[model samples]
Target: MRHTRRRLTWRGTAFLVGAFAAACTLVNVVPHGTILERPFVVEGPVGETLDLSYAELTVTEVRTADTLESSFEQAVAGGTFLVVDATWRATDGYIVFAGAEVIDAEGRSFWATSRGGCAKGTNSQPGYAWRATYCFDVPRDALAGATLRLARGTHGEDDAGQRRDAVAVVDLGIGQHDVNELWDATEKISIEMPGFASAPATDAGGEG
Candidate 1:
């Protein structure tokens, strides 16, 4: 009986030591408070000449009585549909340019590119907005679909003789209404913009 008790005590002590070691390891692996990362997604439009003055880019899921009819109406009205507009500023002494594309549930896709309008600037001041138009013509057949995704692409040459690529995703919905009314609805949507000065070093570290 005494031997059995000693054995049990040894096992218990070993288990406690292992647990304490594991806890220490976990604490070391865990990140501390306050992460300094740039926020993804900005709102507003890319004005004429690539000068973007976006309110904030956001994604919202909308359910409409008639998806086809509403999507059609919004496309016709122009600027009525919710769009994910992407913009960028140079960090780490690089100049970066960004663009976006829209993909439907059925695999249909459309993309927009910057074509000589806005110029790149420092992170503190994201100069003129570089604008590109990504318009999708929702087919009359797609009605009861799942969702739409907006994918962003960033391209530019950095100071270190390297090319960089960045991508982001957002989900949106097609509301049942005319495009004109949809544009007005955009006023209700809001988004959070990352502080230019507080962006990630990798995000702002490379030259473009």
Candidate 2:
């Protein structure tokens, strides 16, 4: 009887220790969330007349839900948006004679109308680029497949500003997870300058 009791006690202690170890391992390996606090570059083509150059973009406040409307609401309440703080370097094939605009998927629009020079101490060139922030409002009746777009335009004393558009869409179902999951999805989105030609390669690489 005494031997049996001792064996049971030892087995119980070992089982508890194994369970604790498993739980600790699981916590360490779990995917919690992502933070894009540093600036990153996203480059692609926009149209024939311009080579879109956009970098130093940051995103924050990601929320998820079963429906687009719900997720958008949460994102808005949490101040979710995209911020672009870089320059648009004109390529040899294109000339940036005007400013740019940001158009959303739902036809909402924002403008970036300034031609400034890049500071000497930064990883930017002495060219022209627009700086702005685009706030995506939670649609009142957004469907599950709702999406948002960011467009750049050339508008000044030049030809009627040509608009080059690029889009980034999010699935509402993916946003329904916890905040961490929503953030992960947002970070995975790729923002490119559609239709524009690629800029002359620059060796301006640094930690963001």
Candidate 3:
């Protein structure tokens, strides 16, 4: 009986030691294992140029709208539309500026409009400047402290770890007064296709 008790106590002690080692391993491994892979986001504001490796991007203007001109019928935004006019100058080879989104202060992201006279994406070659408009359908509250993000590759490609590229984050700079006015204002805006030095305000509208 004594021998049996000793054997059981030894087994219990061994099990306890194993459990303690496992707990220590979990405490050490969980933190490093759960570390998130954050994106390398570079920030800028409107009118400021960002050199995003493959291209140079400058957000010229940001407009809010309830209606869009070209697709006037189905182009109406549910909440409100955020239109961004940007100029791109490619530095390397022909670079395609595809990924775009508007990030709010609360870390909510809204993608650019795929409809209503807006270019789905823009591409430019070296030594040439191109202008395009990206429209995002966002809620009224998203207007305040919003930022426009542009990237060289698509979100999928970035996630696949295929390309480690630079992303341009431009602030919309919508103040409280501007937000109030934008929410109340109903305007029809036209988005232009990508072109060389094309003025978005006067450019011929394309069916988005």
Candidate 4:
């Protein structure tokens, strides 16, 4: 009976050790980066509309310039001004989009500049689509492989407000060749104020 009890004790110890090893293996092997609370990113290119659960987002166009012009204000960029045209159609009630960032290929993020009458974020309702332009002052290296991310949450705290929400990500489709041409551009782009959706109209605007 003594020998039988000793064998049982050893078996129990071995079972616990095996269970711990399996747990450790799972912790190391599982993809921890893909957390369950992460945002659901809807990706697309320019001219394509993406349904982001809360609203419909589209990046209409992207242009580069050295200066930005509005009706009463003018602003210049030390690097280059990237004018992004976008439209949003709200699905639910009133929504305010505060998350807007231009993320480059090398993981560099540039925030929108409202200095040139560009919009930082947008507020819209569910009736129709409204357009806004977001301008980013970015270096030449950030033009290529850049994507625009928009969400209702603020850009602060590592997009903490956007967690577990649907965020829209649109590629600007810029290449290295395009970067040089854009960087050399000396043209001034006209900035428009935020307004409702117009006929056959799409939007562009962010703060400032």
Candidate 5:
């Protein structure tokens, strides 16, 4: 009976020690693991330029339109169309800006749509800024506190391509108060295809 008690006590102690070691490993490993996996996020408000290591990005304008017009196709929004105009200047030799998504205040994400000549992704060389417009069909609730995330890597499940890369996160500046007005407005936006910012379709040309 004494030997049996001793064996039980030893098993209990071993189990406790193994659990403590696992807890310590998690405490040391989890934080460092998350840090290494996180992207280097460059954040800024709309109309301000952010340096995202590989490129510079500026969200120039934000608007909602009932209709989108282009030379080839026209699209009407099922919900409201959120149009985001941005300028990107690559500092690296040649880069393709592949990831574009809008994250709302509630952490809901909306990917950019390619309807009506809108650009879902763009390519640039290290010379000048390229201007492009991205659009999303979102509900009225998503209009407030929406942010635009642009990156060289494409956003896949679990942020697959964006890991450990420099990413641009720009706020669209739409507040809760602006939601009703933006949603109610039935305006048409004349969107041009992605082009060099130095030469707009017509030259009001500001440095992008």
Candidate 6:
């Protein structure tokens, strides 16, 4: 009996050691959510044209509003609506701009809001530039030091960390003082989508 017990103890110890080694190998070799696996990010500021290897993106205007107005429908912001005007010129044939979000100072990310018939993403061709307006409804605190990120692929394409993609990061240029001023003020801004007029009808402003 004593001999049998000793053999079982050695077997259990060996099994445990083997399991631990396998786990260690997986931790080192497998591609998890590590930053090393993410795609390369290109950053720029508002009004500056940026290249993402396959496309050229320009952030034209960034505005904050408490409420969005138009001739037909009105959409109000819970905290504020971040309206971003951007133009895209594709260099490598036709493609779709898939990723769009806002990253606040706290590293918190907010996806683009498709309300008010706004263009969540833009489709581009090789010929001319395409204009798009992305709206994000975020809290008051999200405006300060926020950055907008747009990528060639959708969020799912890059979230797996298996694809090599190009991303454009643009600064929203929202300052500390601007946050208060934006939250309290109501602006009647007009948004128009050209190059693709048939895409959607978005006219955000007060009564016509």
Q: Give each model a TM-score.
A: 0.29, 0.26, 0.73, 0.80, 0.81, 0.76
Worst 10 residues of 3 by lDDT: 199-208
In Å, residue 22's CA in model 5 sits off its true spot by 9.0
Locate the minimum summed-lDDT window of 10 residues in model 2.
113-122
Separate clash counts for every candidate: 20, 12, 1, 16, 0, 3
Best by TM-score: 5
In order, the Cα lDDT scores of the candidates are 0.32, 0.30, 0.75, 0.86, 0.87, 0.76
The alpha-carbon lDDT assigned to residue 51 of candidate 1 equals: 16
As a TM-score, model 3 comes out at 0.73
**Runs of candidate 1 exceeding 4 Å displacement:** 1-92, 113-164, 175-208
Please report the candidate that would top lDDT against the real structure: 5
Rank by TM-score (best first): 5, 4, 6, 3, 1, 2
lDDT of 6 by residue, 1-208 (tens): 3454455677899999999999999888887555556766789889887888888788888887766665556777777889998877778999888888888999888888766656678797765667788888899888899999887777663454224677888998889988888777687555554354221121232111
RMSD of 5: 6.7
Q: Which ten residues in a row have the lowest lDDT in candidate 5?
A: 199-208
Candidate 1 structure quality by residue, lDDT tens digits, 65-172: 111122113112122333333334332232333334455557554333111111111123333222222333233333223233222233221111111222333444
Q: RMSD to the native, candidate 3?
A: 8.1
Q: For candidate 3, lDDT tens digit of each residue in 1-208?
A: 3444455577889999999999999877774312443455678878877877677788888888888766343488898888888888788998777788888988787878778888657887776668888888989888888887788766553333214457877888987668889887799887666677644222243221
In model 6, where do residues sit more than 4 Å from their true spots? 1-32, 70-72, 194-208
Give the clashing residue pairs of candidate 3, or none. Answer: 117-208
Clashing pairs in 5: none
Per-residue alpha-carbon lDDT of model 4 for 105-184, expressed as tens digits? 99988999898899999899877778899999999888999999999887676677787889988989998778889899
